[model samples]
Target chain A: MRFIDARCQLGRRCVIRENEPVTKAEILELMDRCRIERAVAYHAIAKEGDVKAGNMELLKDTEGDSRFLRQWVALPHTFGEFMSVEELLKGMKENSVSSIRMFPKTHGYSLKPYALGKFMDAMAEHKIPVFMTYNELASEDALYAMLTDYPKVNFIISDVSYREERKLFPILEHCPNFHIGTGNYVVHGGVKTMCEYFGAERMIFDTGLPTGSAAAAVSLICFAEISEEEKTLIASGNLERMLSEVEL
Target chain B: MRFFDASCRLGRPAAFGEGMPWQTDEILEIMARCHIDGALAYHIVAREGETQDGNELLLREIAQIPQLQPQWCALPATYDEFLHADALRDAMKENGVRTLRIAPKSFAHSARPYAMKELMGFAAECRVPVFFDYGEAPCDELYEICHDYPDVSFVITNTAYALNRWLGPVLDACGNLYLGTGNYVPHRGLETFCKYYAADRLVFNTNLPTGSATAAVSLVCFADISKEEKELIAHGNIERLLGEVRL
Candidate 1:
């Protein structure tokens, strides 16, 4: 079965000193080796560098690569460097971007509704899928508040740990629009159990490439005890649908 | 590909009602479905109840299944309800059990060199592989134990990812020390580990019923290492370790 890596990073993360920097070629080579036909990639430079410059670099690096889908990261409109909500949304639509990841903690901003009022409004109106790292959405109370406040925007939790079911289960139960990437969701029988509860449509494959094992994540979904149909949805169907159905 | 799971539990859990309840029959059935050839299992009761009862139950429950190898939990020497070093060794010989596991945190005992000198010495002499969970024995404490007893084959199970820095020195210094793959996913880690250390240091484990057997198996089966290394990790290394048990 083919796979689409919904979560991947380009460039190098400064925090990790041991691993070598991942280039666009290596990411593609890894995809071919692992049988992942496509990927949604974010620039690691954005984690610590200026978000605007990082996103631009990501665009330039992936300019001709159709297999590599672009994932832009942003701070709130509170940070004027990215500009007004309308303009940012317009730019993303022009670029055919389906998703935007947030690094409120790393970039030093707040994801609270008040701080990102216009940004959240734009996301909800366009039905854009917003990805947030575990550090940014650390508290369930805060997550619950954000989900309740913006019901239309699709929230995809990224870089979640394997042992996050205790916290993730409750949020999954409460929010309908909430989705999770499979980068670190390594609970025993987690996929089968989650499919039983919420169905396979709520999950997507994310290898957390460059920082996580692509082979491990891909084979995790492949070896899951769930049905072949559910595996397809998780492997690539759901992500493909989400990307295709993005309301521009 | 066949897998030999090094860390797994059978029967009902004593606490931490997170994982689904499992028994020997259920674990075996799951293994059959997942293509795991065999498993070394410890009973949860041993972890939660007295060591004597847990070991007895483990032996009895796993006796009927040829694919299951029972592991005895090590208790402190001062504890009367549990067997001391010599008696425990005798029991293991009689029961045909070769592997040993410890839960120092749950038993509320320190695994410091001073606390476990006698048992550690016997384990080293027996060439038995003693398994310790990540938190059960702190990295520094384990380093000291491995240093003190180089003859003993100390196996650390369920090490968290991103602990290469902590494990690097330990792996470099201790040839007798081994790591199980129950929770040892570290991003191209298998290859990187093989690059730094020999492939024989890794043993196949799933920490099953508590962890995903499929996830654990898939990590090794899909790793970019050679077929020989994969074979070694899958079952050969663990098979060799278990074969050295005299009893």
Candidate 2:
């Protein structure tokens, strides 16, 4: 099955271990090994250093690279530190970027509608899906609040370990736009159970590459006990549909 | 490509997610589906509290199932709470059991030599491999235990992605320390690990009934390593470890 990784980071960041893949060539080689057709990649600097410079680094690093789909890290435009909502949308359109990632916990921003109302509103209008890891939220309750606050914006949370089933289930039941990245959801039969309860459309395939395991991520979907059609949807179908809906 | 899972749990957990495959039959089915040929399983009853009964319970539960091998939970034998060295060895030998699992934090005992000397000494003499979750020993305690019982092969299981910084140093200092590749999900984790430490140190595991067998198997199979290294991780290394048990 063709897989499109919905969560990946490009460019160098701080704290790289001895043999961990750090360069774009290494990341692409790993992706190729796992048969990932494309990855929705943001900049590591955007996450760890400066958002604006990191976003630009992502574009430059992934230039002429069809294997990576551009995803820019977004920050609230408070104090004029970042681009306005209109400018952000215009840049996304011009650059052919289709998705946006947020690091509220790392970037020190609030997810309340007060902080992200206009930005999220534009995302909803453009059908641009928002991506973040589970660590970005203060709690599952906060995640629920943000999802309900901007119900139209699709949010895909990645690296949610196997421990949050009871907490995440209620949110999944209530929130239609909250999708899970099936990269490290290593709960035994978790993919099957999630499909059974919420359907396969709610899961988007992501590897969290250069840090997350692309081999294990693809294996989770490929060997899941769900039906072939459900596997297809999670592997690439849902993400393809989500990106295709981007008005930008 | 046969996999012998080094870390698996039997019996129902105190708390579990909806539709989690905790039953023995369900675990076996999942193992079969994942092409896992055998497993070294510890029982939750023993791990939660009842050390003696839980160890015995593990035997009965997997008595008929050849695919499930018994991995007994060990305590320090304070106040005669568990089997002494001789009795434990006799019991393990009688049952064809080749390994032991410890939980210092859950059992509320120090992993230092004062508490674990006797049990760890038996493990060293018998060449029996000892297993535990990373939470039980953690960072410094993990290093101390490996140093404390250098002869005993120690396998740390159920490790998530955030432990590379802490775990790397311990692996560097301790030759006895082995890693259970159940949920070690760092990108290029296996490849990186094999580069610094050879593939012999990575024992294949599913952490099944809680950890994903599919993800664990795929991590080994699809890792960017040689076929020989993959064989060593998939079953060869674990087989060697179990084979070395003189019990």
Candidate 3:
């Protein structure tokens, strides 16, 4: 089964399995071993606490890789896109990069709807998919309300733990643009439950390995009691749709 | 091979993770996959929200499934338990059980050490190991209780995430305390846990259904350790320490 991971981390802190840097080849090789086809890669910890620096590092490694769709990290709000949002978008176009991811917990920023209001506006205007780190369901509701109103924008949240996800049940039945990464740890019959609640279309297979969760998520994906269609949707289809949207 | 699972739950709620109740079928499947010969399962969280009755519900299940050995739930700070430790002792003896499990979070060791002490004294006399679930337990006095009673054995769950700078002192001070691999999430020191704590002192457990059984077992069974150490931690050491002939 082809798997498109929504959560794959970059840099050398807890990303490596045995205290070594993760080479892209080794990563893809493992993906093949685990049956993951492609993934959107992000920087680890948002770079020296400077998200722009993190974006640079993320872009640096994944820029030329065909298997990965590089998710950029920046809030041109503070880092002020090297020129303007237009110039930044143009540069990302030139670099063949696709989306922007925000790490509120690790980035030390407030993702309260009011906080991300303007950033959400700018991304919506440009048709950019905003990747959010796992905050909480209550907060996700606030973000989801805004993004759902803006039909052009899609937001993906990753790193949610098992408990934080239970709070999502009420809202998951309603919202569609919001995608959650399975790096959320064990949700009990996590993969099974997610497939039941939302078709595998929204689910993304990720290995927040070494630091995130056990390297067991891939196995969970393999073992989840769901159809091949749902597995393909989680493993690759949704990410393909997102990557195709940000075509260079 | 006598199997005693210091950590096992039957009706693992969804909030804990995504799964239906770990009915006997699920347990048997996990047993086949992980090669857990037998388990002394405890229902960690009770839907009824009452400790003794929740224990009763679990015990009732154990009664039906003769393959499962019931280790009664021991949530301290119960006024009834405070008054009736003798009755509790008698009940356990009648059941032919060797251990009583307690979630330290339920007892709040920092706020009430006296109650914890009383419970410890009672368990020591009963000759049953008291299991404590220690995920983000945030307790210092609980360690003090373990230090105070060298003869009493306490099972500390979630040791994988329990380390901080304070770990060195905690490890040095804890004697009768043993470790359980209860964290569903993997940690950095897990492979080292078996070696540093020694296989003799740790039990192979998964806060199953909530946590991945395959993940926890894979970490220990395939760790960069010897086969003897693996077998010892896998089933032998827990058997020796608990002294129960697991069915």
Q: Write one digit per residue (lDDT tens) for candidate 1, span A1-248.
A: 97988888898677664654367787788889999998888888766787888888888888878888888887754313465678777778777677899875555444544356678888887777888867686477777778888888888887777787888788889899888888788888888899999999989999988878888898889899999999999999988887776776
lDDT of 3 by residue, A39-104 (tens): 777777454455667667777787667777777776534222223566667867877767877654
Each model's DockQ? 0.01, 0.01, 0.01
Look at candidate 2 and give me any clashing residue pairs: none
Q: Judge candidate 2 against the unseen true structure and give its global Cα lDDT, from 0 to 1.
A: 0.90
The sequence of per-residue lDDT tens digits that candidate 3 reaches over residues B2-114 is 23455777765546445543676787688667766677777644422556766777777778676567777665555564236767777776776677776555554342455
Scanning candidate 1 chain B in windows of ten residues, the lowest lDDT window is B14-23
What docking grade does candidate 3 earn? incorrect
Residue lDDT tens for model 1, B1-247: 6788888988787554554648667778779888999988888888888777888999999888899988988877874656777888889999888989988887988777778778877887888899979778654456666777888898889887856645665676678889898788888888888877878999989887888888888899899999999999999999999889764
Deviating ranges (above 4 Å) for candidate 1: A1-248, B15-21
**CA RMSD (A), model 3:** 18.5
Candidate with maximal lDDT: 2
| Docking class of predicted structure 2 | incorrect
Q: Rank the candidates by lDDT, best first.
A: 2, 1, 3
lDDT, candidates in the order shown: 0.81, 0.90, 0.63
- The predicted structure with the larger TM-score, 1 or 3, is 1
